[model samples]
Target: MSAPLRVLIVDDERLARERLKDLLAEAGDMQLVGECRNGNEAIAAIDAERPDLVLLDVQMPGPDGFGVLRALPPESPPAVIFVTAHRDFAVQAFEANALDYLLKPFDRERFRQSLARARDRRKALASPLDTELLARLEALTRRPPHEPERYVTRLVARVGWRMRFLQVEDIDYLTAEGNYVSVQVGKQSHLTRETLSALEAKLDPKQFLRAHRSFIVRLDRIEEVEPLPPGEYVFVLRDGTRLTSGRSYRAQVQRALELPT
Candidate 1:
């Protein structure tokens, strides 16, 4: 008697998406509106499709599930079921006011329960952007407070449906491209749907320096720092990639490279 709930599935893993698709099909009361492999696509789908519910994956390259939720400006985003492979994110997922958090490899019964909960909560108009939930999510994504001061060791990036895990040491530099950040590693570069400011917060300041508004360079990778005329400077990476430092960031750049100002 009730109208079928429109649903969207967002996950980087093909098998995970396929499994959710099959399960949703088996659930008689829901209709699949669209499928997105990454957070960017998911955000676009949410804007375009405006589905009644979103099955969001907790971890992915770029925006991830939490980032997607934070991006939505509405007080009440469509119902969401946080699907993730990591059990450690459960508390934070709920704290972010999710409809439910579905752990990876969930059985049909568990999946159905999650779906049912979402269905029941569909009418709630409260926004998922609660301050408490957001704070928890921010903490969850960073290194634990108790651990010794450390920087992120790995970066996850998604291209189409493929996910790439880049080691921090392998990264040559980072450049801002509009709303995305280009993660350059060796000859390969992956565009991630994340703001430079947000990504900078996660990086270790000791190893990476924001040489310019649009650029973040790895300290040990600098092969040379050429002092250009007119008080400008250019950082040459070990691979010969040249990144110009911004005029306003000159002092920080000098200090970072230990160049006498």
Candidate 2:
């Protein structure tokens, strides 16, 4: 016998939202406090209700799931379990050390497994630091650094004949454009001269992750990581553009997290 687990559901798709809600209902012991279609609304709900857990979707119109998590204060943030369809984005999700994931068209068992993991993670922690954990949680969620010893002091991208400097913290995500890598910061995009592989070596693995063969993301700025069909995952940043993840690198990304030995 224990207290009913309070939960919130966030997703952009109406059907997806309802389906998850139904799944939670079947479990019987959990309470469905409410649902939101986007991250902005979800954040408001989180601020007001302060639920114990959030079944968050990676992609949405504004303030996607990751955005909601980022916006949360460290003092009392909720445990997050992502419900997505993208396989590539799994790397990012694993980086976050997510409790579990329920792929789309979820069955009873998958849903149950997700809830079980969430419950276990919640129970394992002696005390929760909502805002603080939210801040540190990015380390586990974004692409890990290349080596623990080295961190990105500053982001340098080769452009044409000159190199431009941007703080690593300023970048939202890195995208591959043909033979180039794009530094996405806020609303502007800057071109860099590097292939995805070469960039991986130069960029710190702890802060930047290779999500897809062509895409790498800054851990702190990721707004959402969603699952997609045809064997792939997609991620959306705070800027509202969606990108795909690389399926092959999923395991490598997971290993970088260096979870409990």
Candidate 3:
């Protein structure tokens, strides 16, 4: 018979650690080697225990999950299944790289699925931290926790004969114009050859809001909001530009405005 997989659970919350311990106990083929409450402890535990798999939380004091991975030796890093509450771009990056990630509040079935995938990879002797994954972890670790994840502070726009750099804070709103996006600043509009959705991904969600399929307005620039029927609304900007919210973005708009849903 194959040996049981040794597992380490690393999370700041005691309840989260306990929950993982309970689940690990239910898996007969898995053995709980240790539990860590923070990133520093996790890093030390990883070195001391040398577990086969780590169920890691992203955010914690000192070094984060990314940091713990970063501290590991490049060769033969343990298999990882990130378990965190963050639903940020990093999660998407992890998915794109074909890494296992279990979002917080995951069900027992979901946990089983993630663990099974990890076991399969281990059996196959696949290297968990590849060049690309290491590069992504390096980038994520460099970002300041207070600032939004790699959000743009400025954007390049073409102005006839010259290239202009526009501060994101100065822009009032953005609207899609066919294959291009129009950056509206007061009365002047600068056209940039980029899709609205693509541009929106780089902007901070706290500062910019997608009001419709064709429009993205600065949250602070919104002077007033007029409610419309069927969970829709008309947002009046500081420059007197009125943009209607899309039906599909109702829940997001409500959350941004702190309105009763």
Candidate 4:
């Protein structure tokens, strides 16, 4: 007989966590091996138990679900189903190849659907740590953690709260910040959990334009580009916010914008 799928529940809310456990208990196909209330705890449980699936919450006290995901080795990806209260980050979650999402106030049927999908996908796969999986994740995440195919969906800002969710659409540009990438948004800039190269892959490139090694702009948000100096231009945003264009990205950005060279 096929081994029963093992699952780990990671959520900050006690009631939500217990409720999910109860839902799983009602079903006979999955075995709930462990439950955690925070990312830190979830990481420990994941490393020790190595569950087949993880029901991860996007928000938590510290080292949130994304942190727990980052903490794991890339080779051992546990199919993740995001349980989030915030709907704005849904696209990013799915972009990360999450099995499914259970918004708050989840019903039994929805839970079952998500669980079934995870199981079916798992059954169709042969091994987790194989090269094909690694390449797919690399193409998605741009880098492999100890667990390939996993990229951080949240950020631990350098000078603020321990956790924050900066959706991919919220990003206006990407700038290399040493080992990480600084994501520019409306008024506040956030440091992401992934490298610049990784963000390039994980992000929907059609929306984001890599203007420079240290700069990327949202294509739809650009208002105009004005010639400034030799092979240099000024990027005017939809909001009239302007930034200097990087030298290297001039031709490429021009090509994307369909501007005369």
Candidate 5:
């Protein structure tokens, strides 16, 4: 009979480590050689235990999972399956040729799938470690992929001592007051700590527009754009809110609203 696959669990959370340990125990073909709470300990444990597979967490206090990978000598690094909560790291993890990227709150079937991949790699390759892949992984760790600018999908707001989550799509407009902006979603309004310019930059330009210096209205919510005097215009919302456009932002607003210049 083939020997059991040696495995190591590395995570910052004690409960997370314990949970993985229990799951590993259920995998009859795998053996838990060691466990590490943080990246520093993970490095030491990897060298000492020489585990065949590492279930590594990406985020940690010091020397993250990537750091452990960087510190390892090229001789024979163990196969890695990155365990992370954030989905943003998925692409890079797979690009590094990881056994699998297991997102947190995963089921037993998911865990087994990652374990099977690790076992398959161990049997297929002469050396479980791929030095070239490690090198590429290190490079990626140093200069991680740049996260593209993303619009706000949801906004957390305070309502009479209770907190409420406001969906961006549900918002009709925003009114700037000093350093704070009142997010108007339908009939209700909620305030958030943000500047108009800062909030504008974070919103989808196609969906929203700076209708006025103090007002930002959802383009789809505009009932009509009423031409005021001398190049200025007032945007009438579907819900009957009228907001005037700023002189400096006239061209962009007109273009966005498909108004004739």
Candidate 6:
């Protein structure tokens, strides 16, 4: 019969990787070629193993799922089934493109269906990098210079296996934590995998202020600003959270607050 379909699993989470491995074992006529923990590893494995199909996670420590796909060779790239915890606009894009994706915490029946689709796609030798799909994905990731910038009204926060959309207006502050940002909304704080500067770019300048190298605070949330020595100041928020300004941000903070320089 036909040769066993070679597959690679790429995900940062150990549990996720294990789950995929278990499911792949049940998927007859498929051989698990390798497993990669991050995007960089996934790229290396994809290049080395040349697997027929890949199960790639959307978010990880290094380049995300889209980044990995972008790095692949244009001609005859491996078929992909995205594994994502997000139910955002990207999901709609995937659907529009007729691409297969496994939403987080998916059941066995869904997994089987997605795998069957991948098998059919492989048999048909369908090129995964369709021009329209790539264009749509690029559009989702970036905006054309001619297009007016549209700031995000909501941010997706992953809680366990579920995703929740947090209104940007409800965010009181954001702080950098390695590769992730801690979004503070009143007493609740949700962690999302986004750089502080990247998130800053999406925020309205009039509503948010970069108070420190690691902190961005909502302008309206500042209840008090206590002056400190040598151009430093401690800001108290409506939620009673206090954040000290970084030395380099002092001037900007002053201008934002219209305080005497």
Residue 71 CA displacement from its true place in model 1, Å: 0.3
TM-score list, all predictions: 0.48, 0.48, 0.47, 0.50, 0.48, 0.47
C-alpha-based local distance difference test score of model 4: 0.70
What does candidate 1's lDDT look like per residue over 79-140, in tens digits?
A: 77998888887755653456688888889999999987766554222223345754554445
Query: How close to the true structure is residue 114 of candidate 4, measured as C-alpha lDDT?
Result: 93
Q: Which ten-residue region of model 6 has the weakest summed lDDT?
A: 89-98
The lDDT for every candidate, in the order shown, is 0.76, 0.68, 0.77, 0.70, 0.76, 0.76
RMSD vs true structure, all candidates: 14.2, 16.8, 17.8, 14.4, 20.4, 13.4
By the lDDT metric, which is better: model 3 or model 5?
Answer: 3
Give, for candidate 5, the lowest lDDT window spanning 10 residues.
Answer: 136-145
Model 2 TM-score, 2 decimals = 0.48
Point out the higher-scoring one by lDDT: 2 or 6. 6
Clashes of each: 1, 27, 0, 9, 0, 0
TM-score of 1: 0.48
Residues 116-186, candidate 3: write the lDDT tens digits.
Answer: 87676554342223457444533443337676568877675655534466788899888774446778887
Per residue, candidate 4 scores C-alpha lDDT tens digits across 1-261 of 678899999988889988998899987888999998888889888889989899999989889666676566544467899998888767556534466878888788998999888766554353223457444443452334566544444333332323354555566666664445666676555544456776676556667777766566788888888887777777887756555666888888788788888
Return the clash pairs for model 3, or none: none
Per-residue lDDT over 1-261 for candidate 6, one digit per residue giving the tens place of the 0 to 100 score: 788889999999999999999998997888999999999999999999998889988889799887787576533457688888876635332421224778898999999998887676554332233457444543454445666866766775544434466788899988774455668886566655567888999888899999876779999999999999888899987755667788889899999999898
In angstroms, how far off is 211's CA in candidate 1?
33
The clash number for model 6 is 0
Show where candidate 5 strays beyond 4 Å: 126-261
Q: What's the lDDT for residue 189 in model 6? A: 63
> What are the per-residue Cα lDDT tens digits for candidate 2 across 1-261?
777789999898999888888888898779999999888999999999888889989888898666776577544457778888765565555434355666676787888888887676445343323456434543443345664554445555433334466667788776554455567777556555456676677677777778666568876565766655544556566755666666786665455533222
Best by TM-score: 4
